[model samples]
Target: MHVLCTAGHVDHGKSTLVRALTGMEPDRYAEEHRRGMTLDLGFAWTTLPGPGAVAFVDVPGHERFVSTMLAGAGPVPAALFVVAADEGWMPQSAEHADALAAAGLRHGLLVISRADLLDPELARDDARAELAARGLGSWPAVAVSGRTGEGLDALRTAIAELVAGLPAPDPDAAVRMWVDRAFTVRGSGTVVTGTLGTGTVHRGQELELDGAGGRIAVTVRAVQELGEPVETATGVARVALNLRGLPREKVRRGDALLDPHAWPSVVEADVRLHGIGGPAQVPDSPVGLTLHAGSAAVPVRVRPLGDDVVRLRPDRPLPLRIGDRAVLRDPGAHRVVAGLTVLDPQPPALRRRGAARRRAGTLAAASGVPDAAGELSRRGAVRTGDLVRWGVPGPEVAALAARVPTAAGWLLDPTRATEAAEALDRAVAAHDAADPLDPGIPLAEARRAAGLPDVALVAVALDRAGDGAPGGPVVRDGRVVRAGDDGPPAAVLDAARQLHADLTAAPFAAPDADRLAALGLGPRELAALERAGELLRLTPDVALLPDAPDRAVEVLRGLGPEFTLSAARQALGTSRRVAVPLLELLGRRGRTLRTPEGTHRLR
Candidate 1:
């Protein structure tokens, strides 16, 4: 189903056009009919030949009800822009035109209503020129007289063609039903009517309803599409939901029923305005303006972030997504002050000194509008929960999660991930060079060196680098490095090899510092060997073979799980300098069960 909204000047025959098309009166209240002006909003639907079912959200054309018009127009992508032939062009026509263009609406039928009252062709030409000036053009134009039924057939055909050509709605997209009307139906509780802009809404579904009061849980007790009860209703259609646990007063015209997981609500956002080049030049001192987004408009304070981007903090949290278009209006002047496209819903706080200027640069770059992954990379890493908060659509984040690795709830950008991987390699190499006789640097230190957002990503970066050829920086066991790095530097290669062989052969006895210094393998060379996993040191003087602990375990197992210190010494054939620590190492590994009396048993 497709939903189209009407736009025109006051008393320009918008409601009359809708009534002619749908054979139902659009004005619901007696006051509206008697006054011949739509004070709120009205809805009517009909079936088109090839496009199936369609609904028309009849919006008020009076300047007094401009906000009501914005509420009706936000969710409906297609429009039936009505202009009375006799009037040609009017004041409200321009305001409505600004609203449509601001919303980025591109599909519709331009109607010359009450054409019998004027020369149809000339009026159409004038209307077309006026619309083009407002940045709206190329829609099929038709002359129609609702009272006389003149040219209604051509109008229908044009509407059908427009709806047929509209981009297909994504049923799997997140549901954001912008409620424009709410009421009570006796025992039915609160019945809210809205345009289901995307995704599908089903009966008995629980969703987050975001409004002035913030988010609250609501259930759809029943759903009606085009006046018929249905289990589900897809986007681009009008839906009335019988809601449970919400008062009619709480379900206001601007409230939104949304997918709790997909549609996150925010009170403030940074946006780039279109048409007028950018949002109205809001000042450092905030000013009140109406912010229109998704069948909702709330009073907001506008502040300029840059020439092209402005920050809007609404009176309440709103369900917003990147690329969603909105209109900013000065109610006093009844003029479209600006038209905005959401750039960042969760903008960085400008609390630090010079943060505003720095963020202005980011906003400038964002105006180029990269895709989801590119934005993520530019930010380095974003908390998974904040993807939508930054105005990225939830569906995009979900798709990205499948493609990228999310470690510890942050989506690591592919480019930044590569940089971090290289950084990790460099940090390990630097540590090994400075402290030659130690294992790899701690994960915390690596994270700090790379300026990583989380320590979890340190391990992830190495895992992604994969195991290298026997002796690369990839030599990681848990958080420690098993120093089998490619090889030590040219200056220490000979000394490093000699130290390794000496430690391997001796297994239990480590050479003294004086002996190490004499061999030209100082503290650094020893640390480097340890990083390469070629040398294992139990103490400053006692370097042991890598397999020494396991060998001790084997001998102790054969000794019937009971042995004294001297007995263990004889088994390993080493003195207490090596035996004591080795025995402790064995006990620590759970290979030997040490009793309170000091006897050791096989664990």
Candidate 2:
């Protein structure tokens, strides 16, 4: 079934034409039947020759109720633009045309009603010019008289051709039906009438209704397509859904039912606006306005992002996506100022200086977000949820499983993963080059250098880096460093010899950090020497040869329970500086303990 809506000036014979063709009254309310003008949405259906079942959404043409017109027209695929023959073009006609154009409506038919009142050809020519100005001139048109049924068959043929050319909606797409009407039946629960944009709705299917306070879970009790009970219904058809768990009064006209997890519920979104032919400048400051997308018309605050980009802060969060189009209107003046293309549904908070300008630059090219491969390449690494949140179709991202790296719900582009791995290897290599005597650089430092978040990301990189841990600079000592710990370099070999000779002369004595640096054997050389088992460094300035600890243990064992610092210095034949630190180390090791009289003794 194909759903189409009528758009024109007030009392332009929209309902009369539909009634004359369908053999059924289009006006449903008593006021509309008495006043002979549509004040709210009216529905009717007919069968076209080639198009089969076609539904008509007759919208209000009165200026006071244009909101009703928009609610009816937003979901329909095509439009029947009605124009009265006597009235060539009116104010409401232009306004209606603007609404259709702002909605990006591409397929339509021009019907010149009341053709008996004036020359039908002249009226058609004027209507054609007006539609051409709005970029809708290519549609099929016909002149008809509802009073005499003149050219009624020709009008049906035009509509059939229009409906035949309409593209079929994606049956598997997520359902986001905007509620145009909600009421309660005596036997049934809450029922909602709307045009299902896409996807299939089945009886007892669960859906989500995003409303004022928060989203409420709703279930479909039964389905009605074209006023008949059905078990299943597809897109491009008018449906009346009997829903459960949602209050009929709380479910307003603009509320929509959508996939809860797939789309974001955000009050603020960055949008790329399409400029309409209006003189209004893009607001530099926050301006109060109304936004129209699908069947939603709600108040919002507009903040300009760039030349044609704006950030809309709606009074209420709505279910929206990245590529959705919307119309912006100044509700006070009731004028269509511009159309918008959603750039990013979720944006960063403007916290730092010049953040807004930088954000504007990111959104300068609103359509620049590339497809699957390009998105992965741009983001470097993304989570599975991020793939959908950033607007990449979930199935397409899933298809890249073999091409990308995935672990624990994280996805990394192959090129980015390789680059990070190579960077980590370089960091390890550099650390090893600087400290030949030390273990690999600390894991923390390597992760920071590679610009990764956690150790798991590094692990994924390392597995693909091809540098095995046993032979490479990436080792585990709490610090990442070169794989091997060789002896000091030849330049520092003399320094090392002096240090060894001095330490051996007095086993408990050691060189300070300055003395080691003077000999060109610094922390790295010391670390290397210790790793090679040539020296034991308990403190920064205290280094003992490998056999020194055993010899000192014996030295302290010979001392009685009471011995002064001077006595130990004399016995060891070392400076007080060396004797003091050595005695402290022995005390810590439990070989001796300090007495109250400033003496050392076996513990």
| TM-scores of all predicted structures | 0.75, 0.73
Whole-model alpha-carbon lDDT for candidate 1: 0.78
lDDT of 1 by residue, 208-264 (tens): 888888888999999999999999988877999999988888878888888887765
lDDT, candidates in the order shown: 0.78, 0.77
Per-residue lDDT tens digits of candidate 2, residues 1-603? 999998895772878898888877878888887887898888889888898888999999876777778888887889999999888787878778877877768799999999888887887888788788777889878999988899999999998889889888989877889888889998897999899988889998988888776788889999999889999999988999999766678798888887656667877888877644443357544766778877788888987766777788988998877677677777667666776767767676778877778878876655835256655554566666755755677788788756666766677777777788778778767766775555466677777887765555666666655455555444454655444544456666667788888877767667776778788876767777776677888765567787765676677566676888887777776677777777787788887887787777876
* lDDT, residue 317, candidate 1: 86
What TM-score would you give candidate 1 relative to the actual structure? Answer: 0.75
Give, for candidate 1, the lowest lDDT window spanning 10 residues: 466-475
Report the lDDT of model 2 for residue 205. 91
Worst 10 residues of 2 by lDDT: 276-285
Residue 464 displacement (Å), model 2: 6.4
